[model samples]
Target: MDNTTLVDNANVVATPNGVLPLAASVELVCSSRTFVPFLFVFCAIYHFLAPLYTTPKQLSWILTTVASATMTLVSIPFVWDYVSSGGDVKSVRTLSSLTYATTRMFQAYLVSDLIMGSIYYRNQLMLLTGWFHHILYVFIVQICIKRAWTQIFCLCALMELPTFLLAISCLYPRLRSNVAFAVTFFLTRILLHLIWCISYLIPSNRTHTTGGSILPSVMLAGVFPLHAIWFKGCVKGFIKRRKENRALAPQAVTVDAVALAHATIPSSTSDSYISFRSASHNHPARKDYSLSTLHHIGYRLWPARKAIYSFVGLGRQTSS
Candidate 1:
């Protein structure tokens, strides 16, 4: 019985598949043995940058940053070794390419599974919180990314896009207040999903075929169009609300001014015109008082009250 394994850190053999094939050479180099270091380094960088948003505590930030940075440093050598291995897939020759490939792929899939599976675990959490919406949003993003039509470069850009958007919202006070900024964020996110779904539906290269997992891809595809409908509704609502507010705002301001005028007008005035003149201080009848009439009244009578008290033999009292 011939066994399959890597030899001399290069080449894979099926025991009976001939003394290692040249076509498998690239596969051997790319397998788990060589890929781990790079994968770990990439994961480390991600974790380091991960605490950037969700967590607000300083301690979590510091710990995650330090841990990720250290792991990243340690992963570098493993990456360099894999790179130098010269694309060989022999069990004993270069390194066990199969072992490395299998391990890393499993690790990646495991992480994905845990994340995807946990979404609907609790109904209460789903119904009452924004977490579900955000999770769905993320799912929409992933479906788009994994779609056949998406470019690898756009996937990279998508990964960085959230971080940048979060930073803009947090750092720039004006972005928080900006309706345009909010619309941009929503549209771009939808656009990403649309591009990904379209990419899957229409592959860039003619030779590529759908892997036949219709259920998952289709579900992901549906989200974008649904999102488009939702986005339109939001735009309509915003416009309607803005128009209503503009119509009501002037009336509200006028009502407020009228209320203020009524409150400040003296209740003792006998004539409406005289009262208006006194309150506004615009007419010549109120030339001596103006807006500081209350102040003038107090200043004029303050010293007379003191003199009257003094003549009554009342001594001045002081607080310690």
Candidate 2:
């Protein structure tokens, strides 16, 4: 297809053969903003349905509610613009200043947020449905009709607010470490997204609009499953270790109690013998070394060596 036709299909006005022009290839950018509320409703419903997924507590719910309400409120103007524009690309620009820059910047944040939200909720969303969102997005982009950047960003921003809310909950001390880890891991993936944004500002890359779209799709496909697999593996390992600990804990406590009693009783008994010997003889010079002396010494020493042996299975004779 000629550059003009390709640009038209992307719903972008062609720039003078540059990266910014290619970035404009993300047509329908603000078009997706129209559907943001519906996406939020879906996420809220999804959050409730999956018990396996973590849910926000009451305080978190308040924060989520407030943030969501604000985001929804801000969309009023954009929605009005969208409705008044009648879905025409030119009409949208007529109503808005720096329409291209505004849309692409939003697109960059939205698309990256969508991919990250999918990663965050993979267990809850995919565990039962096995990645319905991934399949759905694929179908929409490849078969239903080509998606514009507007649509992608709107859907993304819709999903992101909830994920960010969840992240806020995880920032508590108990979960802060894991939250930090997830944040760091998620940031690495955004580098690719940042590239997508930068490509839009440059002109040389516009010739192959498909290249930009394909990069995100390929990255997400690989990342989503990789996250799912890693999460599943971690869950499995955790369950296995917990079961083993349950079995081992009681026995360990019993063994400790018995060992402690055995350890204390002998020392006390030995102390009594020494007291009796000293009282009866009035001095060590008059006391005879009896068979009991040898036995009592051996018994007390046995407990110490046995404790060492049980800990790491060291042989008693090793010290000898």
Candidate 3:
């Protein structure tokens, strides 16, 4: 009856209630049109905060970690609603304003990272892998949003859970040894992704009775292989790193955590730890992340601890 029949789903014109009146304006605002503006915005913000991190990598990690956490958290309620309602058609075909805004914002962030990484953090970016991944996501997210695949997009966003952990660990390498990252990565990216794909493959799946478009399904299935490949490589790398760590004796190749932090961390980050070792309690020269700081604190607390222990021993003897 309207442009609804004439127009395609590639634009955000179609909704559960038929053709949306402000669809064009809203789409333009929430679509890839914001990419350039967001790019400039993120670039300016990161440059402003760059001095705090000392390196593009650390700054980039801070942005991505926050973005990933935000997207994951924001998607949870929508995703939970979709799943709990048993894949209502409205949840899939209907695009909400919040989901649209969140998707576009995250897309802008990813686009900014790709462009900025190319110019500033080229050394940190993987040639083929990173480029292909970001490009694919940036391109696909727009299409998915346009086609109103918010539920599937939200489900896929859970994979970023691992990125939050890994990205934060870049600044704090001591937590890098934790197996939680690898485990979460495998669970979300590999196992959960595989299940989603299988459900998509199943015809007439009651549990996920949303859309049945082959193209969207194909697009989703495509990412599973990439996830699997990344997981495999991650596991191998984790194993190798652990083996190397086990082979080395304690502090054999390294000094204390402070020295290790200095040797490995960017100078900008380490120098910010002023009050860590300052005796005057004012801003004094000291490294916060170190073994000696732990020893110093423990040494200062030992007398009180001994006194408490002696009191407990005396109480126990009196009871006996």
Candidate 4:
């Protein structure tokens, strides 16, 4: 037979092999036809209330909270089953009610969020990453539902737990929440996801009975690195902030030291003041002062010199 005929025959042969029946059953109960209208209604309500929010971030918080909560509810039961089954690949290959609901809800949220983001925060969409992710997720979920790959989609959905935490951190800006989010993201989105994908793609598991395909594996492999890169950026940002705070702390101490020296200089004719005069007379040129004398003078004269130089510099800067 020719290529097309062979492909057609294979599909026809595969129809009775359980996937077709499951796909039909999932469609009958959880049809996209049923989902699209609900999505539209939710979007309408969101849009009507959008003006109530003072900022785009507030609106995002509400939407992300809804998505996160739904996914969390779905993931709890799904995860329990997977673990209880001893990480059996077959456990994830079958679609449960929980998985179906999670998939549909997430797809709907992505569609609504995409529209809301485009309309309210068009600049963010221009960044391409957020826009691409929403579109890609929606497309992937739709394909999975239609093709009886709901179990695989649920495996992907596990990443949403961390995504929810990330949204919480963004909305609240708490150090604890951000730390939790980062750790959860690393565990779920990076480590567990990598393990799951590897298990799914094992050569022994690629049989027709397993319903495995290269496309899902390739898509997941591509996503894994992107997630890693994003997590690395989060780590780098945290480190940068810490370094900035540390640098600022020393400068603050130096400023306080300078202020104290200035206060004390006018009150007393101390040894430091005498030393400054003796060194100035001996050196003549300020530049020619010896290292030891400079150090001695700086120990007492630094605060006064810093304050005077700062005042002079400020005056010059303001005048210019």
- The per-candidate count of clashes, in order, stands at 26, 11, 0, 0
Question: Tens digits of per-residue lDDT for model 1 on 1-320?
Answer: 32655554554454455555645555444544534554455455445654554533221223223332343343334334423654111111212333333234333332332232243222222332234444554444344333432222122123223324434445333554436534554744575455444544543312242344343346546555655665676678779989997787656645534443344333332343344444444332333333465355434323344444554667376798
Give the per-residue lDDT digits (tens) of candidate 2, residues 1-320. Answer: 44544445443465556433444454344435533543454455445543533443422233233344444443445445445866322222222333333333333333333443454543333432334544544343332123333332332233333344444444343543443444533442243334334443334433233333454345344445654554455457668877997787656645533443344323344454554444334433222234564355335534344444544656455555
Reference-based TM-score, model 2: 0.25
Residue pairs with backbone atoms closer than 3 Å in model 4 (clashes): none
The lDDT for every candidate, in the order shown, is 0.41, 0.41, 0.65, 0.65
Where does model 4 exceed 4 Å of error? 1-32, 44-52, 93-95, 174-176, 253-320
Model 3 has an lDDT value of: 0.65
Models 1 onward score TM values of: 0.34, 0.25, 0.64, 0.65
- What is the overall TM-score of model 1 with all chains considered together? 0.34
**Better model by lDDT: candidate 2 vs candidate 4:** 4
Name the lDDT value of residue 73 in candidate 1: 40
In model 1, how large is the Cα lDDT of residue 135?
A: 52
What lDDT, from 0 to 1, does candidate 1 have? 0.41
Using TM-score as the measure, name the better of candidate 2 and candidate 3: 3
